[model samples]
Target: MSFSLRPQPARWFELLTAREDLTLAVETLARTGAVELETHSETATPLVLPDLRGRLEEYNRLAQHYQHYWPQDELRPSNLPGRPVDTFNHALQRLYAWRDAADAVVRRSEALRGELYELEMLREMLLAQGDTPLDLGLLAGAGPALAARLFVLPPRTHIAQIPAAILHTSVHGKVHDFLLAVGPPAEVDLLEQELTLHKGRPMHLPPWLQRGTDASLAALDQRTAAIQAEQRVLEQQLTALQEEHRLVEALGDIARLEWFLTHVEALPVSETFAWVTGWTSDLDGKVLQQALDRAQVRSLLRFPDPPRDKVPPMVFHNPWWAQPFELFARLLGTPARDEADPSRLLVFIVPLMFGYMFGDLGQGFVLLLAGLLLGRRVPTLRLLVPGGLASMLFGLLFGSVFSREDIIPPLWLHPLDQPLLVLAIPLLGGVLLLLLGLLLNGIEAYWRGALRDWLAMDAALLLIYLGGLGLLLTPYAALAALTGLFWYLGARLQRAGGDLRVLGGALGRLLEYTMQLIVNTLSFTRVGAFCLAHAGLSVAVVGLAEAGGHPLLSAIILLLGNGVIIILEGLVVSIQVTRLVLFEFFIRFLRGEGRRFQPLPAPPHKTERT
Candidate 1:
């Protein structure tokens, strides 16, 4: 298991292959789940690539059109990367075949659906007439001599305009007036023009529906049932068609090949060959090399010293228990290849600080349970398990449970009882932690062969800080001045060009660093302050519970109070822990200059498929 203190390692490789074998080389490397190809921007790309890209563009458009039908799962490439033209053409052929078979059914289905909508609307208008006789033979367009029609007039239309000679009956609806009119053809036609002027719509039943209201409704229902049955039959036909053509799997193949071609198109190539370079995990590099030989690809692979020009990708190899702590370190970024990885350290540091601020046994168990229930879905909350365990440990020390102190005796003094000691302890711990940070920086500098430079600047800063802390606990008042003198000489000799003119500037820099050291050490006091706040909140909750009038009332208040403190204080304490760990601790040594490793994904394993 690679721990945080040890650097993650990678092996750099370069590959030279005949242009034709380039596809197989990529395939081998990719399928082995290794190799990040580096592009040489200076190398001239060959003509073959542009043609390949142009062809892939067509498949890309086709993919977009059918993208909704693609499987939700991962897609595996069905074609070798070398045959870019063939792969795209194959995808196009399958898509066109499916579209040919499916289009007719789709169009018919659409037309049938449109007809069904109109039939349903007509049925609804008939039903709304409600026990009133609907005689299509008597309505206008059906009557031979005297024309009769149902004119749905707008609510604001002038009814006085209806000719007194015409026979009419009216029914008022919420928004329109339905009027049945019988008159000479000429007069009814004139009335039609007037209703059209008022922006009113017309409703008419088919002539065949001249049967009484009950019989017309039955006929409408029978026709509706037939149309619905036909729609169901079309749906089944479409499903069978989709299955026979394997439309979804065709889409998956098309998508997979599209992804493959895009990745390989950026190679650094000459007229006849391509060069691929990248860093790989050592084991994967060996596997890729072996696979190339087995596949008889005309290629040469070499494991070379890491490139000086670019930062090699970093891969963290940590034990399972320490894995979750990676989230904290990643908040900043991957650690620089030469600097420290903070993940393992956080395993101890984060939970300790978190537990110190939120020391309660029952709440800790609640968090632990929550982590168990939800950790898989929400990865960040996985920290809750370790944090809760640490909180339980601290709860034992502070003698608190469910915001009550009477359940257990203190293994250590309660924060409220000796707030001074609570405040003082973290300060001392802070001194040690800050000292450790400096040491880690010194160690990193030494690893990089720059220890002398670190000693010149950071070493002086460290001594001055220690001397300042010494004044509080020991007889070392002059120690600060002596360290300040050392800083002056070191700065002048190392960075100031040995000029006396910059003396004030150097001294000012020292004073600035001195204040920073003091402030950074004091920042840990917030840890103790939050601890006291938690204890006080617990006291208030218990007090409220005691003041309640009835036993049930007290229980309710106590339960509710515990829940609020658990959620609200839990969030506050987590934020504090992240703040302290990130800004306070990590800034001491991490520069995050390394690149994260990204291996080419293998062809995804086939999901449910033909």
Candidate 2:
């Protein structure tokens, strides 16, 4: 029997609570993890909530700032499991104070680091001029009116004309270092601009210029040592903040919850009471009521049917054995509330199609072992065991073991021996699948009260497929029925204010359906074709083994050949089977539009078991 699941039923309810009991009531609702709360208000404008937005934003910014130093363990000091919930106001105050203190320290450290970097750059520039045999004091004593600028010119630019203001020029490999003393700021600015136009790089002149180059270097080293000492103290302070990571992360969670609660709208029924509205599962309804009662909050609950616009999220319920197949169905999509779930259908058809495409006892046994071994790590992959078993069964019928035709007697014709009969199986199966899909579509449509789809298009297509396959008395009768249904649909469209183009499009859809049946049926031919190819590949390997001459070499070749075929062919066949079933079969009947059910926020992830 096929098992299916529809969208889970929901009960809409409104709860009236005292103003003082609001906090406890909201906490209980979140803790139950059952309700999907909706906006409840008499007017369109939402009520002004608690101003927690700023606190939440600040918490986020701080978390990001210290994320690198965050503890990598589950046992956080603040958010430990079983711990009592802290007051939001207290947590917020503590976090804000910590952030302010931390920010002040960080800003001071940054300022110190910036000053140290500038000093280091100045020291390097001064050291680069240590080789220049010149009196640095002579330039400093030139007085306030005269200023000296340093320029580093590339080797490509030659200074054929020299101004008298140029004090010294020295070659430093590909660069020409020049020092010019020009009077007044205007003369200095003009000289700097001219040097820039010649592709000359200018170096910043530091304030301190006394004695010779050696004395200036000594002064720079002394200042650098002092700055380095201050930077070390700042680094230590910043490193200490790493221990506060757990506290900050805990504050983040509290801030997030407070932010969410602030946005939730509740109907203001009276000065002392507010009504909160939401939908909950049937199982969780009683649980929620008990929770509210325990909190000493007076409340009333109702189980009204949800409105059309508020469709409940779907949660599939399957038997334990068929549960794994749910993974594949969800990959396509969740089925609509009124549509059929394809997981059970896939459990049967997937193996059958895959087995026919790749049947070999040796390969099948290997696949079974692979699935069992890999299942230890990935539970879903263990579903492959059934497909492997089916393959072995088909292999027995074909009388082939390890792809050697000589090893076993044939109980049925081999794939390569009777290509037409092998091909006909998949083609016939395809036709049956198509018919089944159309029947399912009609059933689903009828269940949803869509009479046009159920009685007109779906019913006509189902009969057309059966009739075309010669299941009916005559092809003429089926053709007449199809033509009459097409005409009826066209007239219905016209009466509904459709133009000629719309009628033509409706007829086009009928033609498309007819063509789809033909094309999809032929697409299944790959099932038979691949089976024969597997046999042919094995034969080719045998030929290579024979041509090798030595028995040991031939045995090794055959072993390796079979291994490759088992891995490669197994994968190809699996993909082909999945493709045909998902695209060709499921798309025909499945309407996967329902939303998957999601509960409230889960507990924080833990890194340590304890």
Candidate 3:
């Protein structure tokens, strides 16, 4: 029912083009987004693009500079902007002009920022002087011979203990305050040591103070106001460039194209022709060829078997309904090239498990509506629609509506009424799922030429599972035991080509496999456990609602309790369902270790001419 085994197939390709046509060829490949250039292949050599690197750095710098000014969530078409991508020389010319304009504004803004910082510092220091009567200019001149110093002291410091010969004044503040003191150079030095012991710190006057505190503060404030006005004008000019975003985008695209050209490794097959080899779909290779032909770029395309060391990139081929579940598989990892695609399997099983546990018609209806609303916006939430529908079906069978079991006759047994069945059903399902996983693993192993894995563990496990299920009578059980025993001993025989020392490893693996089978099957019991918990929780809420003395109070309690059960339990169940699918099901066989295929980024979509 799923595309678990059907993945997109790709063929390796080597594209040869003239040296002069290399850029066009590469651009064409990038635009098609079909070819994955073998950057690691011997033919792929990094190209030298000094000019491109410089331009990329410049464009990146400019983008960061104006990023804050760009409008958020603006509507833009997927294709390239209306204008054509500019040539390198032309783009550089525009970049230079834009950079020059932006640089001028940046320079003025920085200068204003520096001036404003100095002004603020001056104002703070002057304010710290408190309402001192001494003229700041006089204070500056006083420090010339006998050094006048500003000392900040904690409130608890004993200022009176200082030598009386030193002239001093104190102003109390929040945690600490200023102490303006003056004395002979040597005496002031001795007094400073005493202040350090009391946790006092010294403040120095700014070099520009040439007048009284009040006059200096007033002058700094005026300068700060002027600088602020200038900064505002500069910011406005920079923000105005947001309208020219398309130009900026074009610059970025051209820079990236050039960067790619520099980094891509291509083999020079001849004096004039350079070729890059990579894997792409047959259809995509034809598309790339056509694009190159139209550009008048000479190219040779060929398909060949990939080298043994090379692992083909995996591309999932699934129906539209199963596509969303692929997101879940991708989260764990992509399937290995030779492994099965589990997206369809996940789609079928995950929702089924969730519905079985979270059966409730009213709540499921609400969930279905929520899923529909959110699915349009969030691709991952789309899975919830099918899951909700499953829950509604189970709810109908259980004859439960908003936790009131008595509201309708039971089409199936209630969860609390037959707790053992609840537990047994999930365990049985879990065993079947495990067997399915083994079957799939065996199939994958055979395809991958892993005969040992196919026959030893998966095949043996299949027989044991079937035997446990009471299939094939007494001979089946005896054959399953014999197969498992042979598998346990087969590891020793296969180790290092039948080395005796491998006996230890063989025993360890056998134990590990046996334990895994037991634990995996038991893990499904949580499904039934959670199902019963949901039913018990519903009953408890209903009991509370019925106990309320007033009918209105009972109605209110019932409504609130059902809402809590639906929202809170629904979230918890969803997480648990995902966990079972991933750990209990997917982990059994899904390798998910394959690297994702990365195609070259395409140019912006080009708008059609009317």
Candidate 4:
């Protein structure tokens, strides 16, 4: 499935001059080589060129303009040695400056109006208390009402008397009495004196006096309004400057990127490079040929030999659904050079198990809808749309609608209500999947020319699975057959290896195989457990909703219950499904550590005037 490419001598070429057309020719040849080549340039390091000075300037301007919209620290640039560093720094400075100025203007405008509003409110509060005269003689009376109103009162204190000149009111056990004995003119003077006495403390006064003090607050509001208008004009000017900054910054980036690509093409290098190399499978070969043919490449050098060691596979850019299939292909192990179709066994099984455990029609529909709607915005969720749809399909079979079985008639049986069926299906599925994994392992081992190891290792698993299935059907006969086969395989493998170490290794593998059977069979039980948990949780939600008396409260309960089930159960099921794939299935067949192949392509350039 894997190949290592060795570069042929004839394919190598060296460029004498650094002219643009010559650079383009060299790139065309490299692309046609149908292989990734390593090279060291004698000219200036192609990656390093002019700094993004223009981009940094524009970024700074934009940052300043939007400074108020974001946190101060967000606008700051990192000190890394790249275009990003300079660009972000410039943006941060500009944003912070503009943000600070705009914020200050807004603050000033608001502060003036806020002060005026508070002053006006205070005047209105005082006016509501009304005019009252101060009585100096009443302070000496020591009557219950006088004592309660003038100062502190003990618990259960009551106002016993009020003079004709005093108005008394009690609020929440606190008494207030305004003396009406003195005329308005004399009382105003006395009130001014009392206010001075309690400079920092709250003082009781007649409401009429408070109403007459709002002229200053009205004047303050007018000043604040003027300041706010001026601030808006400054903001408008800042916005215009920011747009110009962004356009300049974008231009600088494009220019810098073009410069890098142009420099890569102009390297004074030979077609043949002294470095490690490798070849890829037929699919990779075809893709490479197509890319080259599209570019109209000709007269190129290449090595037709398969790679000697493992090489990175070439990745083709495609839509999201296609990515999973591609990733699965890579995981299953490399295909033979001549093989056109890669194995897709894992793709079907992984999703099926995921849907089975997560089955709930209503929740599944929500997931499908949300996934479809959000997939364009977030590419990663595209997989979930198909996954959710699959779950809903299975859910329908199980008659599980929002975790309640009553909504639909079961085509088979409810997983929770029929515990035996639940346990049986996952175990059977596991047995079959494990066998498939072993079969794949054997096939890959055979292809790699490790027949003995394939028989001793992968074939041993097949025997265990078949023997286990047979035992489940007819215990005594299957047990007898499995015991004989296990011993026979063990002895044969031992004799095949003459070395003492090899025998010991073979024995160790036998023990490991026995342990794996016990563990893998038990792991499938999780599928049943999750199915029951989903049903139980949904029932609990329905019970709680029904218990509530009010319609609104019941509805709220139901909403919360469904939300919890969707988020919590959804995550747990997803993790469990992935675990089954990665550990149970992948461990048996997948060799996923190979690096991907990437070929050199044409460098981008802008035409220059003569």
Candidate 5:
């Protein structure tokens, strides 16, 4: 259950602005830290003007330094030190500028190297072509013949005579060239038979052009190497300068801290120093209290009385359970009072549902261990420890270890092997939880002095719940008696003597109440569904492992299966559990909008004395 906040107005005045006598009175009252003070002045005196001006000048100088080193903001936090806001801004600027300069240098170097390589390649190709004035047209004609024979050509020209006695030309280009024998062979009669014979001629051409290409390539490589070395030197120098700048900026923070302390020490005794001042029409005493508490001071002042409208305070005791419900409230966009404790509900349902959803001992242990390690590193995962523990507990109950039920004898029933028990537990848990909500609702309504609501909404709900239980356990007669009593109390609470309007409202509420009962009960069905899903997923993992022929493959399958269950099923179960708590449980009992308690400001001198 949550408490309501009563906000009141409080205004505080410091002695520095008052007349001598009023100043003395304020100082005397401040000694007790109980009385609120008020003083009005025509004008306010400036405080810390010199210090502010000095800090601003320091900030500007630092900003200029940052702009020089880093023109673009790509520096990581590890590169910077100190939390001085002004100095940090300047450092970031410098880091970005330095990065931009480095990038530009690298880009220019790469572009130059690329162009040099392309020029070198062109020079080599030219050299390979040689000085010969060979007929390129003849070379083109002989290209196909050279390609077919897989022969190389020298940079020269030659001629050949065919068997038909016709002349043909052949030209050798830089890479390759060949001749074409287009005429038919001659026939000679010898040894009583006719035979056709022709002889083909071959010629060799030496490659003189490749020598010049090698020299040009070598020169370009040397030039590129020198340029790269120069670029490296520039990069090293920039890095060193940036490091020095970072150190100086860090030292600046220490200087600023010293300056702040010096100014704080210089303030007059018995003088009121204002840290902050603001005006608001709806400023509440609670808001002032919160500010003072955060400031860790005992004296605070505010104007006008706080608003008296009855609105609950906002408190986040259990963020894990409360956050999801808060989202729902925002969507509804209307005020609701939940009288039950969400933290307790979360405590009960989250782990229970998770256990049912993930009921394999080996996998549950893995989840528990992972959750524990993560909780150590991250504060947010701390809440999940209970849920993990619950999963392990349920896994033990189901007698499942890594989806195999043969590891241990069945304690209750295996989810896959015995589906009935799986369904029964969730349904039973839901009915009981709903009844618990109705009980809380009745208590809350009675406390809030809404007897009519208590008897009509809560009492009728109780009878309906009990009557259902009775019918389930015993006979229809027991249910009828309870039902008659529920209708009588509801009708009386509605004041439905003869008016149709009163009777209609009662009937409508009764119907809405019944609908809530049905929905709340059905919501728990997810518990059984998740249990089956957990069992089925584990079975699939085992199946995949069996399908893999290799021993190593099976191990990999098991690893993957555990990983998937922990990440995927773990998230789904968490969400489902959260939904059950927020919708089913909270809808019945919790009221959360309560303002938090805040205190006042205290003088530094007084703090030291305490």
Candidate 6:
């Protein structure tokens, strides 16, 4: 883990394997998440594998279309004991087999389901015709050509009477009249032609439904049952085919391998060997060696000194407690490989500064509760646990609880009671924090082998700031002048090689940085300023509650006021802490230039191990 100030170190690695064992070797590497494969396929000759693009395209289309028809089983990518390219081809073939076997059954089953709904509705309408036993064959049909039809006549059709010659039964309703007509083929044709003059539209049904009342009703139920039984048989056929082929699961596996192929093709290849080069963490390198040995794949692995011209990718690791704080460092960007990571330091600084500004035992506890319950869903809220704990600790020191100061005795002087001391401490603390930041910069410069250059500027600036601090508090004005003299001399020493002109540029920058150092140190007063503001706002809340007079009203006001203080002041305090860290703290050392390490994407499960 990168518990130290620097980010995790990554080293260059190269992998060589036989052309045939290339997929196996890469799979092992990818599964271990140890190496990021560099793509050279653009320049390297591409491997000539069977074109599976057409197959994958077809699989995808069928997958979306028949997703619901797939068997109910767990889906995951499959790795057969064979070649990687064969995996896609085999899955495609299996999918095509399942589709060919199940396609007709599924379509016919779906069509029958639709027909059953219409049949059921007609059965309901037939039952509504009353309990008097009537032969449905009379209303339906007695033969193929001699059939009956139902018609809906508009209410306004009374303007012209329906022809009495039509052999029909009628039911008048609010908006329309429904008429059933039955006749021989010729008479039926003549009846329809005559009804067209009166605007009667027919509702047609299959002639097979023309049995007697009991038989026709039985026929409707029989049709529904028949449709359902056929669907069950089709479902069973699909299930058997699905289980045998594992089509859905195989498709899942093939889809994953499609992505795998892109990286595989990207590697540079020779007639007999495929070689890839990339970067991985030092620990991952060890893990990969162990994994490769276990897999027994035919591959060669080597680590060489990182090329001087190229910066190796970075991957920062932290202890679990400090992991959440990495979000702060990322806000700036990745730190240069040799630069210090400010995240570990921020773990302490963020909570310390935030708690100081938002001190209140009751509210802090509330925040802690919120964090525990919501942290999983809202990642940023993870900071609340540490911030709340620190706030509660400070709350006890300040002897405050939900704005009530008298509930506990002060372990430390309250901000409202001792404003000067409160303000003075942060200013002094700021100076030390600034000095520490400069020291971190010196460390980074040393790592980069540029300590000699760092000494001429930041080193002298650090001492001058410390010396000025001494001058302000004690009789050490001479020591402050000594540091100033050191700066002038160091500036000349740094620019002696015509690299920079000290009088023209160095003095102006030095003067400007000096002023900034002083301002940044004094800027810490806002910490105490914020503390007093919190206490004052709490007091105002209590005063407003007291003025309200009614017991319930006072309680409501107190709750509302505390909520506002917790949400509003808590947010403001968080922003203030972020400002201090990003501007006042991180600005001292961080230079975000490093590229983040990204390893090859692998199967979610461990599939390559013995």
lDDT of 4 at 74: 15
Report lDDT per candidate: 0.75, 0.66, 0.71, 0.53, 0.52, 0.76
Off by over 4 Å in 4: 1-250, 253-255, 258-310, 314-322, 325-343, 476-508, 597-610
* Model 6 TM-score relative to the real fold: 0.75
Candidates 5 and 6: which is better by TM-score? 6
lDDT of 4 by residue, 1-610 (tens): 2222111121222223222233223343344545454333333223322454454456556545443543332121111223333434554455555555556554664565555554344344334344434332233243443331222223343444434444444222223222222223343344434533443122332122211224323443565466567757755655555453442343333433433343343233333321222332323345444543454433232444433333335433333345554544454544432222222453467567777788778888988888889878986566577678878988898888876677789787777678878877887898778776666666666656787866765565566657756876687657755764665466555667644555666656666776796688779889888877787788889889889998999889988888898889878887887677667866775654344555555333221212
Q: Put the candidates in TM-score order, highest first.
A: 1, 6, 3, 2, 4, 5
Q: Please, what are the lDDT tens digits per residue for candidate 2 over residues 83-113?
A: 1123444555655655665677767766666
Compared with the true structure, what per-residue lDDT tens digits does model 3 show for residues 117-166? Answer: 64654465567665545565566566457778777677757854878778
Report per-prediction Cα RMSD to one decimal. 6.1, 9.5, 8.2, 12.9, 16.9, 7.7
- In lDDT terms, how accurate is model 3? 0.71
Of the two candidates 3 and 4, the one with more favorable lDDT, higher being better, is 3
Q: Which digits, one per residue and each the tens of the lDDT, describe model 6 over residues 449-468?
A: 99988887677777777777
Residue ranges of candidate 5 with Cα displaced over 4 Å: 1-65, 68-272, 275-313, 317-338, 376-380, 476-501, 547-550, 591-610
Stretches of candidate 3 off by over 4 Å are 1-9, 14-35, 58-89, 98-276, 281-303, 307-309, 327-333, 376-378, 406-408, 449-461, 471-515, 547-568, 586-588, 592-595, 601-610
Q: Weakest 10 consecutive residues, lDDT, candidate 5? A: 187-196
lDDT per residue (tens digit) for residues 1-610 in model 1: 2245755766788899877566656767777666776654566354254455676676577556544443455444443434445655666677677767777776777777776765655555555566766565446355567877767666656755788768887666555567777888888888888888787655554555655768777877787788789889877877687567665555555555555566765667675677887778753566877878876777888887766666777777677778898877778888766788867878888898889989898888899999888999998889999999988999999999998899999899888989999988887887888887888888889878899888887887787777777777777656775865677566776686777777777779888877777788889999999999999999999999999988999899989999999899999999988888777788888777777778887645332211
For each candidate, what TM-score against the reference?
Answer: 0.77, 0.59, 0.64, 0.56, 0.53, 0.75
Report lDDT (Cα) of residue 375, candidate 6.
Answer: 96
Instruction: Report the number of backbone clashes for model 1.
Output: 1
After superposition, the stretches of candidate 6 with alpha carbons farther than 4 Å from their true spots are: 1-3, 16-28, 39-48, 71-73, 109-235, 262-265, 269-276, 282-284, 290-300, 306-310, 374-379, 493-505, 541-561, 604-610
Candidate 3 clash pair list: 44-265, 45-265, 45-266, 79-604, 79-605, 80-604, 80-605, 80-606
Candidate 6 — which pairs collide?
none
Best by lDDT: 6
Q: What stretches of model 2 exceed 4 Å from their correct place?
A: 1-37, 40-51, 60-70, 76-89, 92-303, 307-309, 327-332, 365-385, 399-413, 450-458, 471-512, 541-567, 596-610
